[model samples]
Target chain A: MEISYRDMITVLHGMGFGVLFMLAFSGAIGVIYATTVVGPQWPRSQWDNAMFRFYLISMAALAWLATISGAYIIYPWYRAVPPAGTTDLSAYPRALLLSSPRTAGWHDIGMEWKEHIAWFTPIAMTMVAYVFIKYGPRLALHRQMRNAVLGFTAVAFFSTAVAGLFGAFLNKYAPVRGGPDIVLMQEK
Target chain B: MSAEHQPIGLPTGPGAAAILAAGIGSLALGVFSFAGDAVPAINRAFIFWQPSGALSGVTITAIVIWLVSWFGLSRRWAGRDVALGTVNVAAFVMLVVALLLTFPPFMDLLQEI
Candidate 1:
């Protein structure tokens, strides 16, 4: 019935953008592989190439959205400093996780890795998009280039998976919470 | 395969530049992240935005390096066909090493040395 603005944004960051980008990888890779690896089986029409570019562009956009929002918007709330003699640390996710030895690993490992590793997603995907767009059908000719592209795509996916997995667990352990509560529906 | 499918006349340097640049960017993130964790001074220096802590600087710097390197490499390579084999190996090595460097366990292990 009620979700805070911070929580909603976190969900949008992790699910709306992050997970959507993750899901888009499959389609992107499949098409890239199909177009490159199995070139003869399919027609490399201009429309096909255009749609592929659009799909990759959208995926890259989602990757940027997820990374930017996570780093700029929600992270500030998550890492907010607790005033002197503050007993309750629910408002500060980083502090809340660190306050407990049992939960400290979640912050130290989960967040530390996610914060930096998640970045590779956008950078790699953007490059992947650019390479694909620039090379297009000609990509099939350069076997080495094709392999490298696939490798980067797979790594991009790996980075997203690692970040997503850790993100879900981190939220479970110490969620980024604050901001005005948004009412979803009135409880009858 | 038609003339267009032929690899000889085609330009791969631009694509190669983008690929290598991504590897460089990824490695930069790893190196910066590790340095920020290992050194207090480095950590403080990386706080470009107070809200995001060192992560803001780490990512921003890496992106800048990626773009700059890409631009420089692309301009230099242009239509010239560089050695794709060597570039591929170097890029993959850097990328994989960078990925491992970001992992906390790997960072911890390296820091212990």
Candidate 2:
């Protein structure tokens, strides 16, 4: 059976939404733990310091993973893949192109594309790591870096979820008849 | 209860060993998964050669790591016991996610579309 873009969009949406929801909940838990449990009781203790360090490192890893994964998800369609067959242009035409069946296999998973995005991930991750390493604490001077870590974590996760949902919807769009045509074809 | 009876930092009994084993296996699997995807020879050797390196590489590594750590460093790393647990959990997640992302789930998802 020939799957349409809408079908693909649904999958992306469901999986993306599910994972994002989980990450957001986990992030909330981390925040709560940091503020109430670790922040109040163990902030000054050696154990707390160690735990904090571990938590920060984990967060950094997570940030890097999400950033790269997000890029991987959207980049092929966005940069290399031409517009499928749609005309409603917006921020992400490739995703919009999902409305067109013609663009299904149009994605260019070439070496240049892979290298370009893949390399960005490590660099971004390293930068984040360096900041934490150099000035994870000392909020008086490095408040910006600390916030950047937190900010990247929050924003990347949120965007990933939203984009993933859009991706899901894009997967749902049909090339021939959009949504109605598929239903008719199914009925036939 | 006496202080002597409290659970120590090290994993004990069959339970700890199981988790330790699983965790190490997961990490090893993760490393191999990435390696296998990146390298054709390594991938071919493990995937097609004796024992199917892709299948058993992680499990074997996990068992070895678990045994060594359980017997050797379990006691030494008592104070930092939590880190051990965290490492295991992270390893487990990494193994599953890496495998899923690489071979079937994510790849299949894209292919289906």
Worst 10 residues of 1 chain A by lDDT: A35-44
lDDT of 2 by residue, B1-113 (tens): 33322334322222223334333443454455455555678757654324223333433443355456545544554333233234435534643453343333344454466
Off by over 4 Å in 2: A1-44, A66-130, A140-153, A174-188, B1-113
- Scored against the true structure, residue B47 in model 2 reaches a CA lDDT of 40
What is each predicted model's overall lDDT from 0 to 1? 0.87, 0.39
User: Tens digit of lDDT per residue, candidate 2, span A31-88?
Assistant: 4235433333324565654565565556445544544443444333343333567455
Quote the positional error of residue A5 for candidate 1 in Å: 0.3
lDDT of model 1 at residue A55? 89
Off by over 4 Å in 1: A40-43, B1-9
Q: What's the lDDT for residue B16 in model 2?
A: 28
List TM-scores for all candidates, in order: 0.95, 0.30
Assess the local accuracy of residue A95 in candidate 2 as a C-alpha lDDT between 0 and 100.
Answer: 47
Worst 10 residues of 2 chain B by lDDT: B9-18
Report DockQ per prediction, comma-separated.
Answer: 0.67, 0.02
